[model samples]
Target chain A: MPTMFEKIWNRHRVLEREDGQTLLYVDRHLLHDGTAPAFEMLRARGAKLRAPDRAFATPDHYMPTDTRRVAEIANPELREMVASLTRNAAQEGFTLFGLDDARQGIVHVVGPEQGISQPGMLIVCGDSHTSTHGALGALAFGIGMTEVAHVLATQCLWQRKPRAMRITLEGRLGPGVTAKDMILHIIARIGTAGATGHVIEYAGPAVRALSMEARLTLCNMSIEAGARAGMVAPDETTFAYLQGRPYAPADWDRAVEGWRALRSDDDAVFDAEVTLDAAEIAPTVTWGTSPQEAIAVDGLVPDPAAEPDAARRAELTAMLDYMALHPGQALEGLAVDRVFIGSCTNGRLEDLRAAAAIAQGRRVADGLRAWVVPGSAPVKRAAEEEGLHRIFLDAGFEWREAGCSMCLGTNGEIGAPGERIAATSNRNFRGRQGPGVRTHLMSPAMAAAAAVTGRITDIRTL
Target chain B: MERFRPVRSIAVPFARDNIDTDQILPARFLHLPRDADHGACLFRDLRGAPDFPLDRPQWQGARIALGGRNFACGSSRENAVWAMHGHGFRAVIAPSFGDIFAQNGLKNGLLPVRLPEATVAAMIARAEAEPSAELTVDLQAQQVIDADGVAHPFEIDPFARRCLLEGIDELAFTLSHEEEIAAFERRIGRENS
Candidate 1:
């Protein structure tokens, strides 16, 4: 018996090179503005996409989240980048969710939302977060522009088989602990590079019980753990989610029958295994520049002197200096200048509802800024229909349009230099949110709590 | 892409771990036109800070880079690799790399060498202390000759090694077997339809 990863990998193996690398066929190719360069590279080489129908492009990364006309874009480079993607998509004849498309969103979010990503399929994209698609039981991975060009030229990629690892979660999640917390806890236990060279299969009761959207959030950060991809078995939960998606098959019963066969064998073996008790997990937050530097929201900041690893101790010292913090200090009353509750990581409808629940009666603190950018237009429309936007607005939070806003510092939204932010997006690296801006990673509810209190407070305690 | 072979050049020591792609080339600069030279944007943010290692006069014109584990971590933007290559870096010696960055380097003719953690650390320290420090990385020999006359072995996928040595990009390599790929696509398309 083989693991689900192995089964999928074996099925997609197209050609085995003499040097041990295998050329795997790609079923779905997701593209974005970042892929514009690959398209240009292909054009320069006089190449054409092998199967344009299999490829989909969307202009999301560089697009502005604010309601701005094309003429109002201040950055000429951003305008050109967006224009280039539009030009290339039209030239290449690939389906694109342009700026006006209702489906427009982050590539990872749109892929699953529209059902372009399917169970038992191989998906590749130029963006690293493409692993989000693996929640549907697909073997999905990210590739660089060079590899993107290769895939476009020929719908196949040369890859070395990654080892298999299984992480099982038992027990049940406590109140205030979300899927984001589970992933943060995992990264904290196993440093950021813990699972390098392996594809992880999340099994056991805790994972199987997660909704498809939650599973997508878990798999979205697999790359942060240095894993090639993360996946969960496609069961009834997955089938139900995909049942009415736009790109999903019309024959729902037949589609489910195929998806049901995409699970790992009962006796499947993995190269490595880890088990975690979900009961002990708490609302988590990152205290340093790296994802692995996370601790419970109520936990004290680490004391560098207590660190045994000399290199890590120095790194921690530098991190503390950069974050303007000290050892043994609790993050509880740490003042925050801003709060952001969106990104592909936590911008889904459920995430919005969780934050809205906390903000229903509370108002954002004076002198603090907050923004909630939905994951996609559909997510935005759904949130508005449910009056999630009104709840946030009434609570003094600014509800913005959909895009990767404030998550990466590339867009118009940014934190001022030397300011601290409580963000629900992934990554807290130096200047990740903007130059000299410190970002603290948390869940949507935690970020909402921070917005209302103007500090990093435990959501459960709120 | 240029062909890879054995050569010796000055090495810039950036001992930091987890040097993510965002730091390599920030997203703010990613929107630059394709015609723009990526080397100009390499470490643009870090270069502005006075203490960044790349600002040291010692590393001026260095053709090789030395860093710790998980170098080029995060994001699949190939520009990270191109930025290094554009800045005259022919090879990056690290304990580990983000998978996509390493693959991107291979096709772009930038050699990514993975040596033991201890060996990489020692090499970086030596390179930093001696500005004129140079290393000869021989693909054929599968070893990097240190300034002190010690040869440190490194590992690379055999297929990638052959491609780099032959100056064969993935596009060229894949196109060589166009007939077979086309046949396979036709078969799959027919079955699915």
Candidate 2:
């Protein structure tokens, strides 16, 4: 009996390298502006890109679709990186989705929606969020720019086999309980470092009930748990999503056959197993320095003293200082200065709809700056067609263009020094948003409510 | 295939938890072309920051590093490892590592040691107190024998531990496993038929 990860990894295993590493032939390589400079070095060395068609590059990291100067950023270096990626992709004869091109969006979002991400494939990107592609039942993970260059030159990377783990959720989720909450609940159970060196395979009824969009949101946060990647097996739901997809086979018979074989056998073994009750999951929000420091929406701020571990105390204290939050304070009434609902993590149409619903008859609170940047042009168009943008804008939210805006502060969309924002972006580490800015992670809907009320308010109650 | 020379290097204080690749090399420098040899920029802003260890005067020029757990936490950019190696670090001593960064370190010949955080902290403190101190990191002995003869044992994955102890990087190790893998493949093929 074979697991999906095992099947994909085994199939991609080309030659074992001497160092106990498998020289895996990557099935797909997705590149963006921030990661292309390193590969551009290969051209400097006169080494041509080996597998042109197997690779793809796009300019999205620094693309600000809101501004007319999309091609030219204020930052000269970022501008060079975007231009270099566009040129390299062109010279290499690979698909280059430049700014102004409809395909120009987040690499992970663009890949799946464009039908480039397929099941049973091994995908690599230079972005940590590449794990988002595992929604297609692929083994995808982020690689470094050095490895990125090597991949462009050789179409392969040396990888060691990782242990497999399964996280099965039982029962049904309560109202407003989302895939974000599910993943957050799982992280809280496992801690930040729990999945340090494994590839997780999510299973069971709750996951099966999730749409492909929700599943992608779950896998996108695998990095927050310290996992190499996260995946879900394809079934009818997965095949149905891929039916008219640009890259999925058009023939229904072939799609059914492919989807049927995407599952793992019942007897397939996993290195570890964790079971969660879907009914127990609440609207989760994280506090402290790490994602694992999550608590229920109704829970109070964590007391580092209750942490028990000495090492955790110092870490918690550090976070307390950075965030300027005192111990034992309830997370509910904490005032937020900004709210950002964008990034590849939760910038889909469903995410926008969820946020828009909360903001429809509401307005952003005084002194709170709120913005909504869609993940892709298609997502933006779809949201606009549904008046989701109008709902957001009328609600005092600045509905903008598509890109990974306000995420990692790659573009100029960052927080003012010391200002705090409840962001839908994945990471909340100190200065992750800017030189001295703070980010509090939340669901897009939650972020919208936070923007409206200027505090951490439960979306369900709103 | 390579033209770099073996430069004798010393380890500075090790960065701990969530020491992202961006911190090692900021996102700003990421645009300088993949092979741009930006190792000099490793921990640039971090070192320049008033709070970073490198900003401290006493610990300057110390070789052999020690750190807390989860070093190099975020992205799997191999440039992070290369930047450290390029930054005159021969080895990094920590309790644990970001799994990807650890592999990247070994693949690129930046020796990563796994030790108790307390032991690593003690070593770092000792180096800070004595700038001329040299902590003899014997991979073969799996020990960081201090100048004062205080020895602390470290833990490592058996395979990665073996590779480093033998001073053999991943490439050499993969070459040695080729014969065994070929044999296993042949056996599996015959059995399947």
Candidate 3:
């Protein structure tokens, strides 16, 4: 028997050329400013967009949401990239949620909220976090600008069939454990590249128990574990989550019936299976370079000298040198200069709530520049309504507008080079935070903790 | 302007898995418009260091890429596929692949093949032991035959397999069957049908 992923990939496999690849029709294409310029070139050449109606775009990167600092966007290069998004969106006829639109947010968040993401649909976005929409039971994957152009030009994409991998999280999560912890734990065990080249279909008891938001977080990090995409088979939990959202179809009973059938069959075969015991997952924080080079909150820093492989030594050594940390120095008590809590990874409204819940009435450490940016305008609004923003602001943290602020230092929202920051976004590759900036990846809750303590501290404690 | 293909069988081993399109060609390289040779950037960010075993004198002229599952993890960037094709890689061997990579690979006449983990592990172990070792991916047989004559049957989507066998991408195949596709479209175009 085939899994849901296989069924979808095969169902859309329209034409098989002699090369043995299938032409699959793309249902929806989502893109952002950071990955939209090349598509603009196609328009210049007079190539008609293959499926213009199926694509939607938004301006996330390089869109300075902070009104106060808008004037500080002095760099002319970044300014042009921001305008290119609005310009291309206008010229290409894509439905664009530009910066002044109330609906504008991160493309991933906007897709689901707008009901554009649905079960059994094949969705492609230029951004990596496109996996977030899989919470609606859609087959979503991140595409590149070139592929984005191809999809834009042809409305169809050529894709090869993939073997299925299932990651099963058994048992229930412990108190204070979140989907963020579950993925971090997976990366820790498997290393960063454990599930490379496979579609990770999340399964098991713990996964079934997670909320749609939590499931999105899990799939969101599927990239972290080296999986091409991570998804959960839609179930009652999925249906319940999509019931009354702004875009989920009404007459939910009918929707639920379709969703119920989205599960893999009993005898379905998978290429690989990785099991995670959810109870063992603790709050995760990355002290080293990659999202995979992470440890639990209670874990100690990794010792580079003890590393077995030369490659491991180099990676660990590079991270140590860049971050300017010594081996055997505890991850705790490592002072931070800044804390950032936003990204497609963990900038959701609930993520802010989780952070604010811990930050209520607590003040950020003196001299620490802590900030929170929601993933979408809607998330920002929701956080304000829930007083999550107020909690963050009251704690002396900067409450800023949405867009990928401080995530990549795009839009002039940056950490001064060499500043140590506890960031909540995915990827801590060398120079990923900013030129010469050191970023330690952590959960939103952990970032909040770091802000309050000015150091890497366990969220469970604070 | 066209992607290069190996005359015979070649094996290129990329050790990294889940290499998103972004990493294949960094955002810096993305500044160059598409169709400008972005091939050199393929696997550029994933170098295994000067002394790493996988970073070999042997990996210099190989074609078959033995990779981990979810080999292409992030971004929907077509450059990932463009980079792979430009890198002279005709086939990718892994336990699995990213949906977009699989799609993009097939689109550009590159084979993204998935085998059982046990089979993939054996292939990886062999390639690591002898970086120069070549693996034969017989699309007709659907088997990855390593240099030592070890053969392992790998599963592929029949459609994708057909495209690779015929050297055509998905779009070309669809255009070839335009009449049938048109009829099917007309039949299903009605909402109430």
Candidate 2 on A185-225: residue-level lDDT in tens?
89889966678788999999999999999999999989878
Per-residue alpha-carbon lDDT of model 1 for B1-193, expressed as tens digits? Answer: 6789787988888888988888898877776655679998898878957668886887888888998899988888888887898888888999999888888898888899999999999998898788798899999788999998899888888878887888877778788988878777878777666
Could you tell which candidate, 1 or 3, scores higher by lDDT? Answer: 1
Q: Please list the Cα RMSD from the true structure of every candidate, rounded to 1 decimal place.
A: 1.4, 4.3, 5.4
Q: Write the per-residue lDDT of candidate 3 for residues A1-462, one digit (tens) a residue.
A: 879888778656656656555667777888777765556646654666655667777777777767523335566666666667777777777787877677887787788767778888789877667777776677887765546666676666665565688889999998777888788788878866677667789899999898877787888877667666778888777776666777676666876776778788999999998887888888887876567778877777778899997655766776788788888777877899999998888888878988898789899999999989888988988888888877888899989888887776557676777899999888776556655678888778888889988888887777
CAPRI quality band, candidate 2: acceptable
Candidate 2, which segments miss by more than 4 Å at Cα? A68-72, A250-252, B1-18, B32-51, B107-109, B116-132, B138-143, B148-193
C-alpha lDDT of residue A75 in model 1: 81
Q: Pick the candidate with the highest DockQ.
A: 1
Candidate 1 residue A188 Cα shift, in angstroms, is 0.7
Ranked by DockQ from best down, the candidates are 1, 2, 3
The DockQ-derived docking category for candidate 1 is medium
lDDT of 1 by residue, A1-462 (tens): 988898889878778898889988899999987677788788888999889999998767777888635556678877777778888888888999987888988888899999999999999998888888999999999998888988999899999999999999998889999989999999999878888898988888989888999999899888888889999999889988987899997777877887787788899989999999998999999999888889999899999999999888878898998899988889998999999999989999999999999999999999999999999989999999999999999999999877787988565577888999999888888888887899999999999999999999998889
B-chain TM-score of model 3: 0.79
**lDDT for each residue of candidate 3 in B2-94, tens digit (9 for 90 to 100):** 332432354555554444454565544544445668678765645555533334766766667777656765555567777777777778888
Task: Name the runs in model 1 displaced over 4 angstroms.
Answer: B48-51
In model 3, which runs have C-alpha deviations exceeding 4 angstroms? A68-76, B3-193
State the interface C-alpha RMSD of candidate 3: 4.6
TM-score per model (chain B): 0.93, 0.74, 0.79
